[model samples]
Target: MIKPADFDFHFKPDSHWQWVETIALPFAVPEANINGIVYLVTRPMLGVCMCDVTLYDKITDLWEDQLYVDNQQHLPCPKSLTEFSLPNGLSFKVIEPLKHYRMKYEGIDETSFDLEFFGLHEPYDCNDPNMDPLAAARNGPAWDSSWSGHYEQTYRIKGELVARGKRYKVDCVETGDRSWGSRPERDNASIIWWHAAFGENLAVHFFTKHDIAKTNEFGELVSGYILEDGKVYGITSARGSQEYRKSIPIGGQLEVTDIRGKTFEFTYSTTNCAYWAPYPAVTYLQSAMRVNHNGRIGYGIQQLVLSRAYLGRNREALLARY
Candidate 1:
């Protein structure tokens, strides 16, 4: 169970290091065959806040994305029961403690949404004993002590999104994750981060950390749960591989085995490329994908990050091999 205490900000005001809080909401409109994600991130230590809204219009095979960033000195502190608003009309508020949240945005670029998220399952703590030892160790104190804690919970989102004058009802399953404490500076070691929610019943989140020079020596951590028929099963272990076309991720397969030994295999194909944001050290691709989990079709987002040096080496190796 998630208590209100869990929502408290874990960083100290006097700490001059770094910290971040993010709220991600992904939804699909089946009737219209459209999918989208609203991502909000705040780096309190840097006094920066950003919101990225991406919508995939399948009928036209087009992606519309708006990214808004606020780097002012008066950025709101991330705390329980507080609100954050941007000049672009994006606002986030905690309505009912740890169980409910509201997100609204009125963008000038023909993108807007008003959504409410209600938690559907108990929060799964990444540090719990139920996690795989190897996975837990990677996120443990020895790996990155500044990574204080992490937890995630699935939510059923309700509301609407308007893109290009078309309003679509937002009714789907999404997950909200919180990771606090000191965040490391962007480095070559951060390879990729993946997240997906299968309706209201299952969610998966994981990431790989590896040195750019030695990809063979990598550590992966997996955390999530399966909620079916009112029972929750913790994800014990997960293995996945991505297949890419050039720099874009086209498809991939994921196998997640729960503590009970029931494994779910998912085959996914990209539906739209949301954004490809490049940083000094890494390039990130966020896209919506059509996922088939044991024949039950769904839609989710696939976010990938490749270090610049690693990407160069990968391309070189491919050329030499071919």
Candidate 2:
């Protein structure tokens, strides 16, 4: 029912409440000045589910993992949304949607994090047993959402971060016919684990460092152009390169070579490693995050912007309230 092109180019929200609580963009640069911190929530559930809440700081360079919300046993699990945080005690919360999955995020201090009132939504995507990334990104989920999740852990070895966590990733992908010129590029994305957080900041900067793989062969393409106004650059026009300054199951240095050929670099770093399940059954990959653009010498990060919402639904709505 939601055609990608039918959406607004900038941002669009539904009614007084927003259909898009927040979008999960891979990584891109925008003219908009995203200098403050960003609070993001992701829930994967139609039945039992798990949610990830992340706190990303722009100016100070931080992306902290406050907590992981578990709602596997509760039906229509309810959660309170998170308001962005400022170090000076200037913090806030946004009202959750009335009839959709909502989030609960709050910070009581520097040491503790909490995810209150939270609910579960049906999977925005599922995959056909035969589809791939290019197809799935374009056609939406493939199979019916049946995967659950597990606990997470992280660490590093010889500069490379090792990790394992559980969350549904793709088992098989159907690569038959895809719609709207999007069959050859499909692959599974949803990961239960990524990399370990590092540095004093505990955040991952785009391509600076800590560039590891999220999916098997589809992780390094997550860079986009950003503008000076804190506005995010579009993905169709994004390009960059990376290097493997480190070694392990997955480690490398990343760079972006846009159409202009100009390049910016950052060092990716990670620590606090551990092992667990990649999801509920498959034991192929690990999940964790590290300090991005924080490594002095090497390492890196990656992502992609598959689809987007009308910009009107983005910051304008958030800014309108402030």
Candidate 3:
């Protein structure tokens, strides 16, 4: 369980040790042929924040508009992570520890939003001792370097967004994650993080250790949980792989079973995607996806991070094929 103290910054003597909180919200505007995502990452130790918002129109199959500010550095550090406003027009307040939060952003561009997140269940701790041994071991150094103290929760996000003279109502179910540990900028590792929700009662969040060079591989399921019928269950086993086209993820399928032996299967395809380089070597791709589970339509997001070293090593082959 996450304590109240966890909502505040956890700074250490080592400069590399840092705290991070991020929210990814996916929303749709009915009959507008538009779908979008709002993503924000805050790093108190570095005194910086990253804000990304993009709207994509299915009719054109292109990014209609975006407000992306990846480097907001050297700003004054907030005293507490739970409740504080940054100079860059970003503000966060916690209504309940590990359960609810309010986030707002007024960027220089025409994009801005005020959103509230309500947790569907208890936060899932990545460091839980009850995790499967094989999955825990597979996490290895990647977990040690950055994900040592990490927890993720699925939230029902509701708010409003205004962009380019248009207002859209936002109501969706997504995932938010927080972590504090030694995070180096240039680690040579790659991972796939994804979230899918069937409704208010069913949601899934997980991570897979991936090798960028192998485009057809499913990689290894390292950590995750399932929220079903108002209860949370640690994932016991999963079989899934992301489908890629020319090194870019287009869609994937997953069959995940929790500790209770209940299984859920779903597949997703991308509607829109945007790229960002948060760190020198960390190239990230965030996409809004349309999910289909048990023939029910739903919404979700897929985030993948690849290190520059992986690209540098496979540059020739990637260039030839892609």
Candidate 4:
């Protein structure tokens, strides 16, 4: 069982600790998607603490990401349960241990939100006791073991979002994910990450990690689950095939087989809401997609990230599409 203590910062001396918490909501009445991320990165050796808050608006295809870098010694590490205010008037407090979280933010612009997330499912640990989450490595020096741990859960979000002087009530399905470990420098890595949550008590999450230079030297990590009725099924393997137009992802199909040999197929289409992260280094393509699984209809997000240098010829194609 996961505890609220897992939400606390785990900064190791002389090492890097990155704690990221994110919630993504897909709304229908307003035909928009909203996502917020709180990132705290600590480097004890460097004595620095970097905090960031990112808000994404799918309707306007806009992204607002801000960063604050401070001395690690000045940043407060809450031992017990307490509210911590971040830069830009953003703060979060745990309302019900690991099951409920409340967040509020006031932006310099006329953008703000007061929201609560209620976990609908138990927390899923990406790395179990017998499994090595960072086992995917090349022949070289073991890839730094920076990606130490990851956990995620689906939630029901409720609250109000005030943007551009208008307030909109929010009631939708979302996902909360937390990952902590040393930050990997993505100079020569290629990645394919997939996440989906269906209304039928089902969700899918998986990723492919590889070296750009040696594409053959790669690993596929699967951490997916399916909930039907009151039973939870673990996805053992997932295979994905994508179609790209001018190097931009337009749509894709996925096949996930669980440990019980039950398979689910999903077909999804991408949206125009895309965001580029950290400027010229990374680009994240995310979409509020329509998903079809065995004729059952649902909605979710299809997101992808790629390093600039690793795209090669595909870079020109993506530029052309953009």
Candidate 5:
């Protein structure tokens, strides 16, 4: 179970300790052949915050010359996560911990936003004590070895955005997450975090472990939850496969069984994709996808992280293939 205090920074004694709050919001302008993603990450442990806004023009279909990034470091850290404004013109105030939050960003070149996120359901605890012992044992090491606590929630976001002298109304449902612990830099296993929402009634979030070097292997589901109507169900079993263009993920499919014995299958096609490194040792493909569940369509995002060490070991053959 998650409580109000979990939203605050959990500073450990180690120098590598960190608290992370991050979100990726997707927006599009079909008439202009543009689909864009906005990413924000805050690490109070390091007294820094970063914001990145990238716009993808479908006509050119390239990530170059379409990026805006801002970072503020060596600033004062907020005592609590409930309310704080960073030097980078990003401010966050929790209207209600774990359920509602208001965020605003300014001072970036021709990009600014004021948004409010309302949780559709209570935050899902990734480290539930009552989870299946086997599942927990298989997944705990990957997460527990790095972070002390983590949680994810789906939100209905509403607000406005001003980009390059034009204003666009913002309204969408997306997923965001929070994690706090000692984060060391090393050869961590590869992982995929993704989510899809079909209106306010149906949505799913998944975090899984994938071995990128072996492209044919299925991902091992770590933790996930399904929001169907007014209820939320824990995912009991899941198998996932991704379609890759060389080493980058282009699309994927997920089949899952919930605790209530219900099943769901979803397929997603990449609408736009870009790569970035929040930390030097890690780089990930952040893709915006058009997802299909049954006959319904929705929007989603995929984040695939691969360690630099793993890439270096396979560099010769991987580069030759690409």
Candidate 6:
């Protein structure tokens, strides 16, 4: 396992309170591309709507005490949740919401007529630093690791199955809880989840969000395995793992898959994550990701490689180096 220090582990300004500014996609194509600035900021974890996860709250987790316990951290009751998504293929999407978000997917074939209701909370104020501004956006029903978050997106498009989603309805129970505990305990034990329903597979990816550092940078570690068709097994990348393959324009190419560190082929390009600057000199990291599972070669694996400097600074970088 690689340590955080391996990545240089330093922010641009290295301040507590940070801000995120977005630049709209100007060029044409499909979907709306938005550029975002992820500064070291702390804000409320509020957003679209609140959720009701009384189901898990009633249960018991060993780390309940260590969870965020301020007034805003706990909202006694859960409320109706708001669904955030890019209805028109990829029009507008939810980015770095204060707290985490959830998504649910439903469809029959690979592509054609399907729906995904993704939701999140409003981000906290960008000016504040004394507290976590990003997490201030959360609403009713305290956000707990036991409940974790949710996700809903199409696995396949035309009848082929995306490696992660084949046929399943993933859930998050222990994840949200374990997310509040220590790393060893959290990573060692997790009830992660992933759900999908497609032509050749029914897959899911689940894991616990362990704490990254006591500095409060992040109290979650994300890991899980992508189980497709009950035969293919792809373990997820641990938390704080960001792989920058190649630079593109705004809403560029993004490689999203499980199977880590393996030799495979990539026939598709990223459309959402590569953001372009006015002069093409700089670009932001677009959250949009689209990788075709049946892109000529069918599927691929992750190839980890390092470099002295690629994205400007000097350090080790991970890319789809196939």
Q: Best lDDT goes to which candidate?
A: 5
Q: Candidate 4 — which residues are off by over 4 angstroms?
A: 16-30, 33-82, 129-144, 210-221, 278-281, 312-322
Per-residue alpha-carbon lDDT of model 6 for 75-112, expressed as tens digits? 22112112232221221222223233323222222311
lDDT string for model 3 (176-264, tens) is: 77776666666557788888787788888878877757555667777878888888888777777766666667888888888888898
**TM values, all candidates:** 0.79, 0.33, 0.86, 0.75, 0.86, 0.25
Write candidate 1's Cα lDDT for 1-322 as tens digits. Answer: 3367666565567865566555556666655656666555566777665555556654221223423222233345444424667765667787876678888888765768898889886676666665433445553632354345666666788999887777788888765566666655454444545556667666655555433333322246445566665456776666666665544567778777677888888888876664444223545566667788777887666666565666676676644432
Superposed model 6: Cα runs more than 4 Å off? 1-224, 230-246, 249-267, 272-284, 287-322
The better-scoring model by lDDT among 1 and 6 is 1
The TM-score-based order of candidates, best leading, equals 5, 3, 1, 4, 2, 6
Global lDDT of each model?
0.61, 0.23, 0.69, 0.55, 0.70, 0.22
* Root-mean-square deviation (CA) per prediction: 4.3, 17.5, 3.2, 5.6, 3.1, 18.7
Between prediction 4 and prediction 5, the one with superior TM-score is 5
Query: Least lDDT summed over 10 consecutive residues: which range in candidate 2?
Result: 172-181
Task: Using lDDT as the measure, name the better of candidate 1 and candidate 2.
Answer: 1
On the 0 to 100 scale, the lDDT of residue 274 in model 2 is: 19
Candidate 2 local lDDT, 118-229, one digit each (tens)? 2111111112212112223533332112111111111111111111221121111001001111111122332212221222122222211122232213233322332212
Model 1 regions more than 4 Å off? 30-33, 58-81, 130-146, 188-192, 195-198, 202-221, 278-282, 309-315, 318-322
User: lDDT-based ranking, best first?
Assistant: 5, 3, 1, 4, 2, 6
Clashes of 1: 0
Residue 262 of model 3 has an lDDT of 86
Worst 10 residues of 5 by lDDT: 58-67
Candidate 5: stretches off by over 4 Å: 12-64, 71-76, 131-135, 138-144, 320-322
How much is 91 displaced in model 3, in angstroms? 1.0
